[model samples]
Target: MKIKKEFPSIKVNKEDQTIDVKSESNVGKKESKGKVGSEDMQNYFEQLNEIKKRVVHLQKIVRRFLKHVHVTEFRWKSVIGINDAALTGIICGSAWAIKGSCIALLDQNLKLKIRPEIEVIPSFFHAESKTNLTCILSFRMGHAMGAAIRLLTYWRGSKRTLVNKPQPLESKS
Candidate 1:
């Protein structure tokens, strides 16, 4: 008995341990139609209008939600430590808190104000007897908090607005 090999568009030889390969040169070329028709253009514009309508609806919903929702309290904290020698180090911690409310207007603008309270604590290992605590009321934390809240609110609102809507049925004539 002899072993035989075969493949589509290929020739294999087991006796001589050789294979023949073939490629079509016209495989890269495709026939092109003349031009886009008026119906195709009409369909494209209709789809665009539908998308615009959905976007407007989403914006209205977001604006309404923003107008009613308010942030009553916010807080953030961070700590850092450094060691200059094997037995000694310095440690520091800071925190900020803000309380406020905001309202979003019909023109997609926001009105907001916040009062922030900040605290800082520091300690040095070399000076074991010395530890300090400081407190202050400032406007900087208010700005930072406002920006953060706006960013988070818009992100969450956009996520909530993304719902799958049913596509219109097409008449297959």
Candidate 2:
């Protein structure tokens, strides 16, 4: 009685075994009229549909982003000349291998990963004295946003699971 007096919002109905809190929005609504099982099934389906819609939408956005994620409008290039043939050869070999590096590294896990693309443009020796090189690496903003969203979702889900218990609409009557 004291608790009810203190918290009028709490509706402890012991008859139907449902404890629903009263809000201004649901004050006059028939939230407790239907059979509990039927209502629960309906709500479960509604929630499932909502989740499916959101997940599909998220998937579409992610795929579209993966296609045009990198902005080619702005490109950074570095041109250098190495005097030593051995050093130049080593650098060229490394660049060649790395240029072919693809998203195969992270795509298997989430199919939701991004790898920055690098292009190496090598030029023949001007006078056989120096090897000219143009190396470009382009990264996209979408990768950061995708990573942030993934981390936040993982954190929210784990936190909710570890810290909260399944409460029956405030307190089960």
Candidate 3:
């Protein structure tokens, strides 16, 4: 006898700004473990509005946490292709070309790449290895106090954010 099992997976597509969650569950069985209750659902914008509010709150916490974060070292080395030298050369060249912009973007968001304490190093090796990657990233210990303070302060602020804006009525054509 063989047992049949399934796994769950979640994929995020940044370009499309969408998330795909896939899972196989025995919800229809006599005893279901992952049943969604009716009370957890809303008819329309209520759910989406609540989700939006949560996203905003989470973003605030992340930004506060990031403010406390500092990168001390970032190093990545990759070598592509073994049998085909042309492919390896092209990939290596492309990686080198994009390295500057990648670092610039990193610095723009983190604001630590250019600091004297940070060591940013990226390299492309054309040695024998179909695909190989070596990366080392070291960041200073981020204090959770800032994020905690921001969370508490947000709750103490005005209730304007909690007031759900009225959803625009849809036109019936």
Top model by lDDT, which number?
3
Ranking of all candidate structures by their lDDT, best first? 3, 2, 1
Q: Which of the two candidates, 1 or 3, achieves a greater lDDT against the reference?
A: 3
In the range 1-173, model 3's lDDT, one tens digit per residue, is 22222334445557655444444435432221231222223423575665446454767676667665565545545444434556666766776667666667667556464332222222234344322222323434435666655655655335535454433221111
TM-score of each: 0.21, 0.26, 0.39
Best by TM-score: 3
| Model 1: per-residue Cα lDDT over 103-166, one tens digit each | 1231133323343222333333333322222222223445546544554554533443324433
Model 3 TM-score relative to the real fold? 0.39
lDDT (0-100) at residue 131 of candidate 1? Answer: 23
- lDDT of prediction 2: 0.42
Model 1 scores a C-alpha lDDT of 0.35
Where in model 2 is the C-alpha error above 4 Å? Answer: 1-76, 102-153, 156-173
The sequence of per-residue lDDT tens digits that candidate 2 reaches over residues 1-173 is: 01111122444457876544542223333232212344554665675555444343555545554564432232223233366656667766676565444334334323332334444444335313222222222446667587546534634232323222223432322
Q: Rate the local accuracy (lDDT) of all candidates.
A: 0.35, 0.42, 0.47
Error in Å for residue 68 of model 3: 3.0
